[model samples]
Target: RFGMLETVSEFAGEQLAAHGELEMVRGQHARYFLALGEAAAPHLRVAGQTAWMDRLEAEHPNLRAALAWLLAAREGEEAVRLAGALWWFWYIRGYPSEGQQWLSRTLASGGSSIARAAALVGAGWFALDQGDVTPGLAALEEAVALQRAAGDRQGIATALNWLGNAYVHERQYARAEQIHTEVLALRRQLDDQPGIAASLANLAGC
Candidate 1:
């Protein structure tokens, strides 16, 4: 159930107070953040520019609290999972540097999942943007490998799409061309019109 806007504001006030050490309820604020985290995930599932992303941008305060609570509570892989949900947001919105920081910390915690693929992809792009192509490619390769083993078609395509870009950064146009061509085939097979368009654009850059 979505919390009313007014309810979220009230809860935020309470949480801010708790953080200020003015007052702290045993479970109220914690529960509020927990719920907020769950609530935020549906908004992130699309992983690109969308109305949901606009909503996420609007909920920065509450979203930050939910994410902060997960990390501060030492929630293990849950923290990783929570942060990984923002991979698209980070990549699309140009927060790769911050994404790398959070994901590196998460990966250092020995987290693993389908979410792990998201972390790797985020780290890969962040590293690539920083011009660390080797580690970037390595992370992306692992991400693609994971998606393949999991038989996740969409995930594989997503990883490979970026992996192709990583290759471009390395001046490996042959590899990038091949990867994009492969992506094109997959997109055609999947009848992913948008993906096919994207693949065409990627290939055009090659």
Candidate 2:
């Protein structure tokens, strides 16, 4: 019995070492994901949404993994960038809570204002979905202003969309309609059919 116990303890030590080695490998794997995420983010900008949904689904695990690693490495800016980039994917994939949590942490970790604004919009969207209306609306409003100052029309439109939705939830139908109307006009100017359809649908909801 003593010898068997000794053998078991030795096996446990081996398993522990294997786990440690796997973690070392995970760090390398995470770096690969970081590169892939950066490359993929730009493409999502022109998403037909469904096609990118499948792509983002496949990469979802790696996205989470990369987020964990970057945050752990104190690369908050990079983490913010990646998380902000995936906000749309996370929403479409029904992983808004995960997206919200990632953005919140990265934003708090202190990145560039642009990144922070992006994260705020992401977080605001999920927060509104989760019934956190007031703060969510505030975040969305602030993000829209920030993005506007930076001349990021797309970003401003993104935050405005969220704010419009939040106003709908709050039963501020007139406000919601006005916001979505502006979004619709912006999308038309950008020749974004998908965005135009989205804004029109939201406007209809109001």
Go through the candidates in order and give the clash count of each: 0, 0
The candidate that wins on lDDT is 2
lDDT for each residue of candidate 1 in 41-149, tens digit (9 for 90 to 100):
5566445547757765666555555555656666646667756666666666666776677788777665565778867887888888888888989999998998898
Query: How would you encode candidate 2's per-residue C-alpha lDDT over 1-206 as one tens digit per residue?
Result: 01237688578657867778645655666667666666666666564756766766887776787788788878788888888788877887788777888888888777877887878887887888888887888889988888889987787787788888889988999999999998898888888888998898898999
* Residue 147 displacement in candidate 1 (angstroms): 0.6
Query: What TM-score, over all chains together, does every model reach?
Result: 0.73, 0.72
Tell me the spans in candidate 2 whose CA falls farther than 4 Å from its real position: 1-31, 38-51
C-alpha lDDT of all candidate models, in order: 0.74, 0.79
Model 2 RMSD in angstroms: 7.2
**TM-score, structure 1 vs. true:** 0.73
